[model samples]
Every structure is written in C-alpha cells, then in structure tokens.
Target: MEKMLSVWKTAPKAGLEVKEAPVPKIKDNEVLIKVKATSICGTDLHIYEYDPWAQKRIAKNIPYIFGHEVAGEVVEVGKGTGGISIGDHVSAETHIPCGYCYQCRTGNEHICQNVKILGVDTNGTFAQYVALPYKNAWINDKKIPHWIATAQEPLGNAVHTVFSGEVAGKTITIFGMGPIGACAVALCKAAGADKVIAIDRDEFRLGFAKEFGADVIINGATPGTDTRKEIMDATNGLGADVFLEFAGAPAAFNDGLATLRAGGRASILGVFPKPFEVDVTDGMVFKGITLTGINGRKMYDTWYKARSFLSTGKVKLEKLVTHRFKLFEIEKGMQILQKKEGMKIVLEP
Candidate 1:
C-alpha cells in the first residue's frame, strides 16, 4: 500500500486539491516513473477553469490526476517493457496512440483515431509517480535540464507548428506569445526565419518573446493599433510570408489571416472555443493561402528534432521558466497562470 501525493480534480470548478493516493502500478507494457518535474499547460488551465471545452472533452469521472508535460526517472519497468529500464531519465509523449489505428499505421500517430492524452484521458503526471506505456517514454539526454526536459512536449508542439511550413528566409508572424508561442519565436529564429514578429496582449510575454529572438514585437491589445499595418511595415509592405496562429483568440486568427501574403502558409495549433465566422472563400481560396491544422507532435520525429534544438542550445527555455513549486503548491501555480502573472511554472513532485 504505497501512498503518494497527487493533485486531483475533485469537481468541475476553478481549482485543484492535493491529496493522498495510491502510487500508480504499471501494466506489462508500461513503466513507472518517479516524476522529477512537471509543467502547467494551457490545456491544464482550460480544465482548471472548467470551460465549455473542458466540460465537453473531459470524461465524467472526477477526482482524476491531470498534468501532461513531465520529466522523471524510471523507477520500475513492467515485464515486457523493453528498451526502457530503471534509472533512465525521461519525458513522455502525452498522446498515447493505439498502434493499430488507421492513423497510426499510416504514419500519423499524433492524430491517431484512438488517441488518449496523458492527464486528460488518463491519470497524468501531477503526482509523485505515474505509469505510462513504454512507447510513450522518451529517454532524455543527461545534459538537458529537468525543466527543459519536462517542457519538450509543448516545445514539440511549437516545433511542429513552426516547421510545418518553409520558415528559412521567410518573414513569419506568430500570433500569441504564450509559452508555446514564445517557444515558436526562438525556434523560428534558430531555423533561419528572416524576420519573426510576435504579437500578444501581454507586454510581459512580449518581452520574453523578444528575449527568445523575435525581431519585432507588437501589442495586439493596444488601442488604435493596426496589427496588419505593423506587420506589413515590418515585412516591407509585402505582408508576412508565414502566419502561425497559437492564440486561439478569434481576433488573432483574423489578424493573422489578414496579414498573411497571398500564397503564404499558415499553421494553426490553437484550440478555439467555438467555430467563428471566417471568409474562407476570400481569405483562403482567392488568396491561395495554405492552411494546416496542427494537432500534436509527429510521434517520435518531432521529439527528435525538438531534442536536437534543446541539446544544441539553439532554443533556450531557462528564461521562460518563471516559477517553480512543489506538488502541494499546485494551486498557487495555477493561480499565477490564471492571473497571467508568470510564464512557465514547473512543479517538482
């Protein structure tokens, strides 16, 4: 009867509670990890608020541990779980795909029809211990810091979004300067984007985006400001060659589209609350814009690329980690996120 402390969602409300729970036991194909570090995610924030999307997506089961991004040391490897062993430092790919699904077989496991996300569909990493399928475990390089190691999942999202289109020698505009959006700024610059424009309502996040290598920063919340004009001015009046929408704000979506040049590419990773009206015929068809809906990392491909960037020091996230807390302090961490008072917060369990 081994007990562990966990953050549990006791109700469909705006909070989480720390309580004692049984340590997760691994299945034959799984491994048990003693979580060293985990980060708060925007998806976790959505669930914390019990928003409409969370209500619709989260299963009826309450009192489940929920957190996805994590890095930890393997303490136990279940029988038949090969390639992973005790003492391995690792992070996990949150999307646990059913390997036999059509999407998985077709090399699109990230969008597997039977995908179950960690912390969402199953018990997540917001605890002292978590059991995950061995396939989802990514062994971390010893040189990677625990916080950066835990951040790879979201960093992979930014990697997938930024590299979805040709970024080298391109003028790119990223709408939303949240953690992932800020990650995209550094990634795009490292990948050789000629100009990277970061837009967000929060100046604090904009400052971080600049620190991450954004060539231009625009406050979308500024009154009487024309975002398109600012982008056009920065892009020599030709408009941005690429637009990445990570804000999920309808206004940001429209602005990104408006500032995109004809034939430009747009990769959207943001999750919208509800469908909004968009002039698809004019904005997409006539303008010949290539729009891609990004879901998650491309199984192991994006993970490898993201790891390379982090290991080579091309992408630095140390500055993005603004706060740290122990497992019992998750509520305070969530509060900081809700108030938009911090960037990335890491929790050690």
Candidate 2:
C-alpha cells in the first residue's frame, strides 16, 4: 500500500488541506512521474478563493488534487508509453487534448474542444507522484533547474501572447505585472521590441518589470495616472504598436485598447471575471485594430519556443523564483501569493 502526501481542495472555499492518498497508477499509455517541483498559478489562486469563475467551473467532487505546473523525474512507464523512460526529467503539458478533436486535427490542440486540464479537470500534480499520458510529458534538459522547468507552462502563455502579433522592433505595452505579465515584459524585450512599457498597481511587480527589461514602468494605481498619454509620449505620439492585456481588470482592458495606435494589434490573454462592454466602434471598427484572443500555448510549438527561450538564456526565470516551500508548506505559499508578496513560489516534494 504505497501512499503519498497531497494537497486537496475539500470544499469550495478559501483553503486547501494536506491529506494522505494512494499513489496514482498509470494507464497503459501513461507514465508516473515522481514530483520534484510545482508552482502556484493565478488559476490556483482563483480556486483557493472560490471566486465566481471558480464556483462556476470547479466540479462538485471537491476533494481532488489541484496543481498543474510541475516538473519531475519519470519513475515508471506503463506499457504503450513510448520514448519516455525511467529517470527522464520531465514537465507536463497541462492541456491533454483528444487527438481526434477538430482543434487537435487542425493544429490548435492547445484549445481543443475536448481538452482536459491537469489541475482543474482532473487530479493534478500537487503531490508526491502524478500519472500523465506519455504525449503530455516534455523531456527537460538536465541543466534546466526543476523550478524553471515547472515554470514553463505559464511561461508558455506569456510566449504565446507576446508572439501573437509582430513584436520585433515595435513599441509594446503590457498591462499587468503578475508572474506571466512579468514574463511577457522579458519576452517582448528578448524578441526585439523597440520599447516595452509595463503597467501594474503593485510596486514590487513594477520594479520587476524594469528588471525584466521594460523601458518604462507605470503605476496604474497612482492618482491621475494616464496610461495612454504615457504610452503616446514614449512612442513619439503614435501610441504603442502592440498592446498585450494580461491584467484581467476591466479598467486595464479598456485602458490597453485606448492606448493602442489606430492600427495597432492587441493580444488578450487575461481572464475577466464577467463580461463588460467595450467601445467596439471606437476601439475596433473606427480604429481598425486587430484583436486576437489568446488561450494557452500553441500546443507543442510554444513548448519548443519556451524551451529555446529558457535554454538559450533569452529569458531568465531564476530571479523570478522568489520563494520556495516544502510540500507541507503549501498553505503558507498560498498566503504569500494572496498578498502578492512573491514572483513565483515553488513547492518541493
């Protein structure tokens, strides 16, 4: 009777509890990974708070393991699991797409109609071991640190958003400085954006944006803060060439659109709590703006890009990992994230 420690979402409330559970068995096409590192994501925070979105989405089962960003070593490979073998370092692609779906067949597996997410739709990786399909396991370079490997999933989101439109030699404005937003700042810089402006209410995250190579950092919370004017001033009055909305706040969404040049492209990856009206005529029709709604990474393509960014040092995540906790200290980690006190927190099991 092998057992493992797991963090369980026992209720639709603001806390998670540690409990003992049997180590999961792998399916014929899956492999078992001995968890090494996992990270807290904004989605995890949403579930912890049991917000309106989470209340509507999280199933009633209530006692499922709930973490997705993870990196580990393969300890067992079931029959039919090819290529992946014992002792391989790996991370998972959270979205498990059905190979036969229309989206999957058309090269949009990241948003497959029948996709299953690791933490949200099924048992997740916030435990000593997790079993996942072999196709979802991404092999990691031994040199890549465990925490960086775990950070790749969300980092992929940033990569997807930044590359959604042309970024090279363009003026870019990023609204939000959370972990993924911070990653966007760095990615935009690395991809040769002529200017990068970062906006956030949090002073710490603003500073982080600067460190990540943002040319200008704006405090969106300050009284009389004019994001459009600041962006226009920085771009020589033409407005930003590209606008990325990673902050889900309604104000940020509106401000981001307003700050874009008439023909600028906007990539939105933020999850809004509720639908809000935007001036479609003024913001899109009249302005001729191209709006792209970004979901997760572009299946395996984004994974390759994220890996290259990390391996080539084009994007550095070591500094972003501001804190670490043991498996038992997950509650403390969640508390710190709630306070917005850290960049990335990794749980070692």
Candidate 3:
C-alpha cells in the first residue's frame, strides 16, 4: 500500500480531518495490517473534542493520526516477526510497553512507566493500513465478526476490572454505562454476581445496562434522583460488594467509594479530565476498601480472557455495537457518540 485514507487531528483545536496519509512502514520487529474494521474509543472522543486533557497530552502532536481499536488482516510481516504471517486475521493490544522497565520486568507491563499507547502516543489503526509491533498483534479467531473483533481490546478492560476481585455471588455496581460499563454488567452477570446496579447520566447507555442484566438502573441526571442512595438501597443497605467506576465524574468517584462496603474492592478505569478532591480517609482508608487504578489490559492475561469470552459467544458484542460507518464517515460517528446515542461505533476502511 502506498497512500492510505485516515482520520487525522491536524490541529490543536477541536474536530478531526479525513485525508490521505502515507501507509505506515513496518520495522524489523513489526507487521503491517490492512485495517478491516475499527472503532472509536472515549479517548478518541477527548482528542476530537480537544478537551483540557487532550490539550495537555496530545496537542503538541498535531497533524497526528489517532484511533486504537481495530480488527484487521495481516498484509506484510517483517523478517524478525515470528508467530504471525500474511493473511492472518488479527486485533491489536493497544498498550505498547518497553520490556525492560521495572513494571514490565515484574510481569506488570500493562503499567510500564515508559509505555506508549497506539493512538495517543503514535500512529493508530483508524487508517487503511497500520504498522504495529508484532508482539502486540493479537491473532483473532477467524469466526469472530470483524466489528466484534474491534471491541476485544476494550472488552479486555472490562474483564480485567471485573476479575480483579472476587465477583462470584457479590453485588457489583458500575458507575458508568459506556461500552466498557455495559460489558461489565454482562460480565458480572455471567460470572454469577448476585446483583448488578448500573448508574449513568445518559438514558441511552443506561438502556444497554438494563439489557445486560443490571438489577437496578439509575439515571443520576434524572431530576433530583439520589444515585448514591439508590445504589445503597439496591444492595440491601450494606452497599455494593464491588464498585467499578468508569464515569470519570467527581461525584461518581466520591459516591461510589462512599457506598462501597467496608473491606470491599473498587476498580477504577476511567480517565478524568482533571484531578478532583475526594475524602480519602473516610472514602478509602477508614473503610478499608481496596482500590486499583487500571491503565490498560494486564499485559496478555486480559487478552486471553477477553478472547475466550468473545470467540466462544460467552459475551455478545454485536448488540453493544450500536452504529457503523465508513472511515470517511467518521464525522457522523463522532456526532452520534458525542450525543450519547451510539454505544460503540465501528468504522470500516
């Protein structure tokens, strides 16, 4: 491939541009994949909106291509890349880690200090072709739908968060109804959770939570609805045994922790635009709750679990994918996503 179609953030301002870019060249340890399907992520939305977080993190990298989630076919493989070949169907692990880092050496490469993200830190998969480190190219099951394959990376986030603590028979509350939060609802149900409570400001996303088996769905934005009290009441006043926070809202953070039972676990995977204050002593220390800040999939562990759930039909993704468009129609996808009408929007090149 010589020239490629891609969505680009060409300026430090809001919005993106779809234009032609040179097909990425693969290094000795990399592979080139023809993108068959790709999807937008919340991170992509931030970059497109050029929020404060985007301004501080990626504005300097203007004229860059950004999008991480994808499913594609291997078109070229470098000499040093083994266990992967041309024609292999694949999805990518978006976290590119430096193997020699302290965290990487300790089997926690998911949090490597020098990690580089696919879309945020480098050129990404929202193009006709992309070059990726062979180690990060996850060979997909040929039977998995291309659109569904694009979600495996994000699904891994849900799986990691759900399983980070004991989930069986526990009451779990997820404070966001985004794609990942929806997946967490399904995961908790499939893993034998006794009750699932989902909270979100958007009614559209809350609908997915209901379909995925949340025992109670609360619209925190609904006129004067007390979300914290609703969650506590749903959990029989003991509060949730586990709280998974993905809303990235300050109120959600404080309320989620305050409602969690003492000695319970909380897994937070959201990226807040800015740091906010919280009552740490009463919220976490005095309560003796466990909190884990998830960054990316846990190296390859989450990958294996995510693949098993997706390929075997254990967790359905087709329903969660509410919109689709050509890569050229990225503007439409972005609009729908911003309106909260689309759950996970897939783009084809």
* Predictions in order: lDDT: 0.91, 0.91, 0.91
Report the error of model 2 at residue 159, Å. Answer: 0.6
Stretch of 10 with least lDDT, candidate 3: 306-315
Clashing residue pairs in candidate 3 (N, C-alpha, C atoms within 3 angstroms): none
Candidate 3 lDDT, 158-265, residue by residue in tens: 999998999999998899889999999988988899999999998888999999888889998899999888888998899999999988888898889989999999
Task: Give all TM-scores, in the order shown.
Answer: 0.98, 0.98, 0.97
Best by lDDT: 1
Provide the lowest-lDDT 10-residue window in model 2. 53-62
Better of 1 and 2 by lDDT: 1
Candidate 1: 10-residue stretch with minimal lDDT? 54-63
Please give the distance, in angstroms, between residue 250's alpha carbon in candidate 2 and its true position after superposition: 1.3
Better of 1 and 3 by TM-score: 1
Off-target runs (Cα >4 Å) in candidate 2 are: none
The alpha-carbon deviation from the true structure for residue 224 of candidate 3, after best TM-score superposition, in angstroms, is 3.7
149-231, model 2: which lDDT tens digit per residue?
89998789999999887999999999999888999998999989999999999898898898899999899778998877887
- Residue 238 local lDDT, model 1: 89
